[model samples]
Target: MSATLHRLDARHGRAPSLDPMVQLVAGDMNMVNAAILDRMQSQIPLIPELAGHLIAGGGKRMRPMLTLASARLLGYTGNRHYRLAAAVEFIHTATLLHDDVVDGSDLRRGKRTANLIWGNPASVLVGDFLFSRSFELMVEDGSLKVLKILSNASAVIAEGEVNQLTAARRVETSEERYLDIIGAKTAALFAAACRIAAVVAERPEAEEAALDAYGRNLGIAFQLVDDAIDYVSDAGTMGKDAGDDFREGKATLPVILAYARGGPEERVFWKAAMEGHRASDDDFAHAVGLIRSTRAIDDTLARARHYAQRAIDALGGFAAGQAKEAMIEAVEFAVARAY
Candidate 1:
């Protein structure tokens, strides 16, 4: 294990939390929130109403926080990051709205999903509106480099969504393919969010690449832990029910690992489950049992720790200070959440 991972694993007494990062960016976040609220408005009442449902809902705003924190790390003192950070959040919120529609998810952040309450078409159209708004913010920023990064990220996220949709309900999906899906879907925006901060700060390309690496690795670790939590956390804790992925037949990392490591009978069960033949409460319980017995969750978490270490190491060029500490702690928090 890397020294950072060892230190993180040794912190059993006090679990890592995003509080430090949140506090670090609190002042900047207020301005970003203002920009978000102002830009999401529309002459059509339904647009803001639906958009606000999820935006006003209690998301941790992690992507925007990364933008602000990265700017802080580069010693940037300008107000440009506030608007760009809001743009990052708009992209993220738009994706969540679309994802809940695609996944047929009923709950998010422990509340009814926008699609469930307002219907799928409304949710989808509002998501489109948010996407347009994000582009407007990017255009207004007037930096082609920033625009390219975020625009490319938006396209990559859409491609990733389609890729994942095509790969859904296949128990034989390989770990490598799964990684590619998540790299585009989740990590693309993370890398763009952090990389754009360096752009606005007029930092060099090396710093931009470093921040991109940090965000990319952290995003992969974050999604891996989230996949693991689907089998371990309840709606109250994770804002979604335990076994939601299993019920939906989504081939997340845990399911992939368990299927790869199972015996003949276990493999049959997995194939049937992914084919939607077995979806009872008892079946989910059995799936969890097989996962535990196979040590899939443990090894999945191990993989997350590996990426989390890389994320921390990516910041090595930055000078040591509160921004660096909070960013490292944020990675720790991402990997620690499944515990």
Candidate 2:
């Protein structure tokens, strides 16, 4: 974590800690990471090489960790969660690869994207391979319910990607539509990841629903902060170039709000920069200025906080413990990235 993040976390009491949760699930997480490494291996050589580059890129593995932590919290003693976590990660990594292609992104997790190092075709094909591998793991688990949840999430994610593609460079995108897009694109997997823990643990239906709700809300808040960070964070801080969203003309929450509040002249600037592809560094700066002036970032963060609180509240039925606390901190961590 950055120093700035530490300060922000400190202000919120001891409610913002991932360490306790990570430590509690450390053994299971290690097994999940090993499974990820083992599953990435193939005779093609290039497959593991390219996939490992992203897998080892030092992400916190937050999604899979959620799966592991959820199972541990629910008192699961079986090994199924490890495999499930690995499968969850595979699904997520596959999406990242394809997303980088669609966005023409060069950086991910602070490293050059595989699509940049290799060609787009290779990156995309490898992503397909990972998706297939994830399904195989799901089959090994021998649960139609788990398969249905993950498969449905994968389909929803694809629909979200298509929605985002169509919405890009169109400033007329509504906040409701934007939320729908992010909810499907990003939150679906999170919801699946957590919900599957209950499936494997054979928990009650109410517990399963609560975990799904927690993951869904956290995922939405995470994306909201991510969009806000794109307008303000630097490559060193966020692992991707600042203003990449603006450059790509992604009509994220901040952009939607700013465009809505802008005057006619400001609207012209927004249209020219976002729709007409006339954005330069200076124009990007000016766009940031306008967004800040409009308090779009503040509004975006406020919306994110609302979801974060919802995520925290979803754990109301679960007893207070290390895992539950970690899950709550994870929600705060998601929102804190924008700081």
Candidate 3:
């Protein structure tokens, strides 16, 4: 990674923001949004009504934006990306709807989760509807390669979810296993989203592979930061309550590291907490102190920086331009959110 691609600069006394990437893809996103709205409509009022509750809710739409930006980087002028980007978003939204239900979560993006409002069955079924709609969009695009990449990603995501479910509350879960989980559950779609842009633009295989690397590493960095935020941030700042992961006994990187580094007494406490034996606010505060004492959060952020740098370096072949700059900054913003 080059020094120039660092997440923070001394010249700018603030953290990086997603504004650049958001601005760069704004116009194209409007088209994608239109497609999403059109496809979300159904004869059964409940389908649209339930889907709209979460779809119209606050989300950065980062997955679709990556597709548009990747297309821009490749200088593709065709409109096929619009529907494809919409498909990418449908895949992501469907995952989110299903995830909230699986996690039994109450809040998302500072709002009540759809599962909480509409019930688990409704949320799960609507998620299925969105998944079907995404496949429809893919078929409409008429690219076997694109369909294969995304459909494979969808399958990998489902497998990752099941893998995480099995690992849940297991304090002994290894970091390597955790990475495999996130790589499939989170980074697979990210990789597919950017790779498909290359397919649509008729770019060479190398460029497709490069974009996949960029999105894959960025997705890992993004998830790392999100996991760190669970310990450092509040509901207002992070859109989900602080310590939710701790209460849920999620074996995120920080917890894994802290458990590895802790003394026997600390390890016992961690085991109890993960087993749902310690869940009070005081217990959570103690867990945070233990994680801090072990330097878990700092090291977690350091790991995030490592992957973010890799993501930046993955774009080395692309020419320096607005699209590349925005893509790089987006990677910066992914890790910077923890600060």
Candidate 4:
């Protein structure tokens, strides 16, 4: 394990639960949940059915909580945050729907993926419907600024997906390039979600930007831990097959690092397994051995810790309180997932 992770383990024992952050915004979250169920409703039974299945599967609901907690941090007390929170969730859910089709996976959040149950066509189309509904919510807010931030994020997220597609199965993918991919694909929405809270609160540009920075760094850390854990986590723990990234030829950070540090024979192993999509159980075992031997997972967790610290530092300007502390704790909660 990385020294940083070791220190954290000695200090905290384990990752703090997200419950404190959830409790901090429970009232607002209730409103956001109501709006989510209400907005997801449609006359077409299939649309609601499919969307509801995924929604009912349950996620951490952390993104919208960031939106709510951020607004509270800025002392905003308006109902607009609720609608905006729901819209943020809709955007996230829509992306997950599309991503499952793209990744061709069977599980999400410990349940069968929407795409697996409803088929890709229904999943993709319903995802589009959610995208449309998100836009409608933004339009209802009547804030061009909100629309611009979210719409821009929506576009950048799609671009990030395409970027990942381009980089997939390419063993030569660089760390910098991988960071760029996750920044847009994952962090862009996080940045937008938090930024809008400040926007609704009419806070200063500095505060908005600070919150955006917090979310951006936190999102990056979150994805990095995700990549690292996928190498070791079980199907039950990770909610997807272990080595799914390898099976799909995804050039995530861990694989990229392992490839870079591996000997000539190991490089050839990665190339053949990735290119041919022929990673058998033995090949997977070998890959894990290489990753552990090279300290790739340790290094990946180290980088995630770096971003998590940056996320906490970004909240320095906020007053010390529940909102700020919860946000700070969120940084720990995000990075500690690797353990």
Candidate 5:
């Protein structure tokens, strides 16, 4: 983990932190991870193989951890938090599987995506299987409110996918439109993950809402940071290629912000890179230069920082403890993470 920070500093030039949140989260994250790992092993022949494909890819498991840690921070004392944590994670992984298929993506965290490795048909079916599994687990929780939250989030995620597909490769996509898409696709689940923690804790509605706001803003920050890394970070550090958004013709925050501030030459470059599918190597390089010259990266970082701050602020309403402190550090750490 220290190596990660060194790379971030040597490259994008981030500050050295006293405690990196990923590492802190890592210390105890695997306790909850075991629940998912164990559930993922249930066999039905090929179904096991399909599940292994995603599990072996070894994601950060951020969603589940958020649920677990939020519950702990809020002083919950029960085993239900673990199950709900797994439920949210299943939903998240299922979405990723479907997303890779829909976007025709071949890579994620530098590994072959499920659609790329298992064929799209298998990926799609496996994703459906996982979604069903998540729904079943949510039902086991036996709380209609929790069921409703997950169901609503799932629907929003589906809508977000369709919205992005409809807007794909279009230079006309505005900043507001992009935000709405990401808010639905990414932030909705995040908000539910934390809000459900409060529900399981049997906490008041006010506490639930505060955690929901934290998750929502933090999720937005996570997406913006992801978009920033898509342009700025290296494959080794980011676990994905730079210009991923570019290759997909996705009008990310930097691109949208840059376009809004570009001159005639920059505008022409933006149009060609986004709309004209056939882009030269020179076009990608020029787009990077244009983005760098405009301070779009700085602006995007500012927005991410704002959301991170909002997350920490929301935490203030909760009780003071290690979990709370870790949550604050985690929010800040994610904003400054190498990946």
Candidate 6:
């Protein structure tokens, strides 16, 4: 293992000193829970092709890991973490399936999207199956509170997706609305992951609240980086193209901020090329130029840093444990990653 991973494992017993994110990677629970996850796959003759394709092309199971690691760091030893982890992963996968369909994306994780290969109908249905299966797994965990958290998060995710669809091409997207969508879609799961850990650990209300905030801030920081990456990154490395947001006429933070800073001519150009779908190759270059001219990339990075710091701050109330350190490392890792 890498030194970072090893350090996390070595400090696992010393709770409140090591970072939980690192422990999740370095310790044995990661392997054990992952093996438990693998067993969920079984023969279903009719659904074999679609199921195989989706599972085989998996992305990082960051959401599930968040759930499992949060519980472990909180001193949870029950196997419920396994089911919760699997449920979170299943929810993430279902969202990906629907997202590919909504974005009409052909590629993800450097491979063909399930929708692209199986067609939208099959992809949507399989996504539904996963959603149902996730709930089934949660139910098997037998905690009504856990069921409620995931259920609420799932609804919020759907709401965020709808908000994105309706808000597309609208030039007047406020920062408030933007945050609303992101919190619901991205942060909700993060909050759920941590909250469930508190529940499993039988932590006090204050501790649960702190863990929830940690997840919330971490999630916001994560999506901010993701949105910024859309503007600045190469599709090959990003597993999706640059300006995917522009092509979809969706106003991300950079686009939103750039609009706030644009001259009349720049505004008109964005309206026609981006919101209006009348864009040509030249328009793409122009939009990039405009975003760069305004330093929106830097602006977005500053905002990302703010959220990352908030995420770190949330851990302070904890007893300076290894889990808290891991939480901090995960935030730093998110920020240092290329956006």
Whichever of 1 and 4 has more lDDT, that candidate is: 1
Cα lDDT tens digits for candidate 5, 172-222: 789899899989999999999999999988889998999999899889988
The prediction achieving the highest lDDT against the true structure is: 1
Give residue 208's lDDT in candidate 3 (0 to 100): 99
**lDDT scores for all predictions?**
0.91, 0.88, 0.91, 0.87, 0.79, 0.75
Q: What TM-score does model 4 achieve against the real structure?
A: 0.95
Off by over 4 Å in 5: 1-31, 41-43, 233-235, 276-278
lDDT of 2 by residue, 247-269 (tens): 88888999899999999998888
The C-alpha TM-scores of every prediction are: 0.96, 0.94, 0.96, 0.95, 0.90, 0.88
Instruction: Please give the lDDT score for candidate 2.
Output: 0.88
lDDT of 3 by residue, 1-339 (tens): 223443333223556778888999899999999999999999989889988888899888989999999999999999999999999999999999999998999999889998999899999999999999999999999999999999999999999999999999999999999999999999999999999999999999999999999999999999998999888845367687888899998999999999999999999999999888999999999998998999999999999988888888889888888898889888888887877
Task: Candidate 3: list runs displaced more than 4 Å.
Answer: 1-14
**Best of the two (2, 5) by lDDT:** 2
TM-score of 6: 0.88
Candidate 2 TM-score, true structure as reference: 0.94
Off by over 4 Å in 4: 1-14
Model 1 vs truth, CA RMSD: 2.3
User: What tens-digit string does per-residue lDDT give for candidate 4 at 243-335?
Assistant: 888888888899899999999998998888778555788888888889999999999999999998888778877877778767877788888
State each candidate's clash count. 0, 0, 0, 0, 0, 11
Which candidate do you rate higher for TM-score, 4 or 5? 4
